[model samples]
Target: MELLKTLPAKEVIYSFSTLNPPVLHIRPGDTVAIETYDCFKNQIQSADQEVAAIDWNEINPATGPIFIEGAEYGDLLKVTIDELEIGTQGVMVTGPELGVMGHRLEQMESKIIPIKDGKAIFNERLHLPLNPMIGVIGVAPEGKPVSCGTPGPHGGNMDTKLITKGATLYFPVFTEGALFALGDFHAAMGDGEVSVSGIEVPGRATVTFDVIKGKHSKFPILQNSDGFAMLVSAMTLDEAVKTAVEETIDLLLPYTDMSVSEITMLMSAAGETQISQVVDPLVTVRFFVPQHVLDSLDIQLFS
Candidate 1:
């Protein structure tokens, strides 16, 4: 196992496109323990901090473009999240131009929430359990740089709450060594990220990386105790849903004898459509097929 420490300027990459040299290099099957910054770069530490004073460009800093030995384009990179530990407090902010209800808001707002004994203390009367998650994670794209704030074929800012501890994420390898990076820790968030932000905070994450030669995933795929989910992002919710369903069908085809119609039927009955976030430049949707459903069909995501 190797340790990759957080250095706000160097190791923390702001965009997936402007690929820099890897801060650290590790081979497949190696474990790496890394630290990540909050979406605000820890600039707003107190609730009373001015939300309008933030620099948007400096938000969502990711931990690395860590190079993995032997990981090449057209291959798949499997990352198993061993742990995601967050800080005692997190900041959630929103502006008139953000979120589903952004158009109705009058001005910018911010909140500093403290986590105590596993719950986010929203106020004196309301608290919710902590569900720490990774909000931004991806490999460097093949062409022009994509901001850490958007999501696409090359995953970035796909604020899916399911990306928690004990989940395995599979990303398509577009560039050599994958050039992977991650950040934007959320102490807790709901589907759709309806408010345009979650309990954003800085944290440490431990993960293991491995190479899956030859096979590639067009979008990110997640595997957890409950089932398998394909993370798809697009320009609109309808398009994102369509892409996620299509890709999931393609993935399920090789393992089942079910015809297209039969597969669609099965999916309609056993699969679920989940909204990741609708706030980014691209919308994200997740298509999930339960573990029991796959088990019944004797299907496996990777052989």
Candidate 2:
């Protein structure tokens, strides 16, 4: 096992660019206990606070550029999330120009909610069940640097709620050591995150890493207890969904005995797709096909 704690304002990567110096190194099958800050860098404190008051440059700060031993370009780095401990409070904001509902707003609005009894206290009259999730996570991109605010093949700020505990995220290793980093905790968020933000909060995530030899896929894949999902981000929801389904088909082909036409038929008949987020620079769509469906065909996702 290894350990890596974030040094607020330091030991963080705001963008996935060329590899950063490794703050911690570990071999495959090793476990890491890491700390992360909220998307706003844990700076905003109250509902009355203005969105413009926050520093945009320091927005979504991920914990590290962790170097995984033996991870190389074109390989697959498997990150199994073991645990996520969210903070007691969170913040959600909506700016006039910032979300799906932004056009409906006349002024910037923000809310600070308290979490207790497993609920997000939105106000004295309203509260909702807590569904904590990680908002940003990924490895370095192969090309030019990408801001933490954007998401692409390298997986930054996808804002996908499926990235909870007990999920395994497989990312392509474009740079040596993988240079993995993650942050932007959310106490809860809806499917599209239409409001432009989740219940942003600080949290800690414990994960285990493993490198799959020469098993790179076109985009990141997420496997949870329910099923296997292909995560793809694009400029539009339609494009994202298309790419996700296509990649999922590609991944399923080699594992099953079905031909391309048969796979396509099965996906059209049984596959489900959901929105990961619509607020980032790129929208993410997840195409999910149940494990049971694959099991009926004797398909193995990892193989």
Candidate 3:
């Protein structure tokens, strides 16, 4: 298996403009490490940089292009979170997408958090621990490419901070080599990401990869170490949530003993689903089930 020699900060792409994304090469099971910078592309580091220095054309930049050998269209790529380090100074702010998002900034607040012992000091006033998450991660689409701002089946701007270590993310491969890229590291982000920002910081993170041949997924789903399944719904808040709940069942059934019919019956009887976010234009549904329930299941997700 070949390895990624290194991930350089200067090599990171500052823009997103494609449908058939650029190819990123990598082995299926290899772990790749990356260094993340603050979302403003070093605005904070420059001290003189304006808080709104982010030009409309240039915003969040992701570090990647890791290719998975043998990956092809109609396949599923599994990404595992291994490590995420949040910088000492984290910034949270109101995003320009607010008016369109129909949410008020009154409830929004700016915070500077310090990371120590894998925890966050939300403000000089209080503490809010976190589960560092990659706000953007995706591959190219078939025939066309997508931007880094939109989170979809290809995975981008998920903003789900709970995608911490020990979780696996599944994405549909729409191109050869699965041109994967990721950026926008958030120290901690609230649901719906209403303010359009989180504890945006730069740090070094690690991830492992797994590839499944001849299988595809409509959207991304994550299964946590604790037996919880999260179905991500992106686009239109309402649609995002509805999509997440339905997909949660899709993720749950495969890991359960119940046949498709049985699973349907169980849902009709008493099933559970919870909304994880509504602000990212990406909603996540966390399906909780006991290990005993998954123990006897013969189901499998993705096909």
Candidate 4:
């Protein structure tokens, strides 16, 4: 096994863009440990701290624009998340006009939850099990700079709960070196993230990088033990869901001989449409295709 180098969170970026320079450079097979600040940039410490007081410009700080050698446009960057270590305390916030339930709230509120023995102490009476995941993970886009708060083809704040340790995320390379970065660690968060935030915490992520030449997916793909999922984001939830299904079919088309109608029928029978988060500037959704279904068809996701 090779040793891992640590990329400090001291230098962070607000957007994934080609204009941003890389803080670290590594080969395709190299594994690095990346440190990150919480979604709030670790500004909200105590419950007394007001969300309005925090600087809007400092939100969702990603650790790096790491340059992966040999990665180029039209290739796929395979990121295998090997481990995650979060801080002892995590924060959550909700406020007026912030998220889905924001319209019903009169003011902003913040909660400081303690992590103890693998659980988030929501309160004295309620303790939720920790399911640490990365809220923002992405690469530089081909054109304009994308904020860390949005999710798109370049993969920003998807806020998917499944992007945890042991999962592999694939991003389409749009520029030289891939220029990847990630942040916004969540101690635990449910689907929809209707509250505008999760148990946000500062953490470190250990990930291994690999480049797959001559192939790429239109959208980011999250792969776990069970199967592969197509992550798509759009201005509306309905649009995101529809795009996810369409992209999934497009990915399957090249590997199988099934017609579009046949694949659509199979998806209706075995696929799952799930939400990643609804609070971001764009809503994210994922369409999952089970591993068994692909296996039965003799299909390989990246082959």
Q: Relative to the true structure, how large is the alpha-carbon lDDT of every model?
A: 0.89, 0.87, 0.65, 0.94
Q: Which 10-residue span in candidate 1 carries the lowest summed lDDT?
A: 1-10
Cα lDDT tens digits, model 1, 85-190, are 8999988888798999998999899999998899999999989888999999989887998989998788899999999999999999888898889999999999
How would you encode candidate 4's per-residue C-alpha lDDT over 155-226 as one tens digit per residue? Answer: 999999999999999999999999999999999999999899989999999999999999988899999989
Residue 158 Cα positional deviation in candidate 2, in Å, after optimal superposition: 0.9
Number of clashing pairs per prediction, in order = 0, 0, 18, 0
List candidate 4 stretches off by more than 4 Å. none
Q: Estimate each model's TM-score.
A: 0.96, 0.95, 0.81, 0.98
| Model 3 bad stretches (over 4 Å) | 1-4, 14-24, 45-49, 95-111, 228-230, 248-262, 268-272, 281-291, 298-303
Q: What is candidate 3's lDDT per residue for 167-269, written digit by digit as tens?
A: 7788888777777777888877665565567778887778888889876667766767555454555555566555655666676754555687777666555
Distance from true position, residue 274, model 1, in Å?
A: 0.9
Root-mean-square deviation per candidate? 1.7, 1.7, 3.8, 1.0
User: For residues 173-282, what per-residue lDDT tens digits would candidate 2 score against the true structure?
Assistant: 99889998899989999999988899999988889999999687889899987889999999999998888998899888887788999999999999998998998889
In the predicted model 4, the residue pairs found to clash are none
Show model 1 residue runs off by greater than 4 Å. 1-10
Name the candidate that leads on lDDT: 4
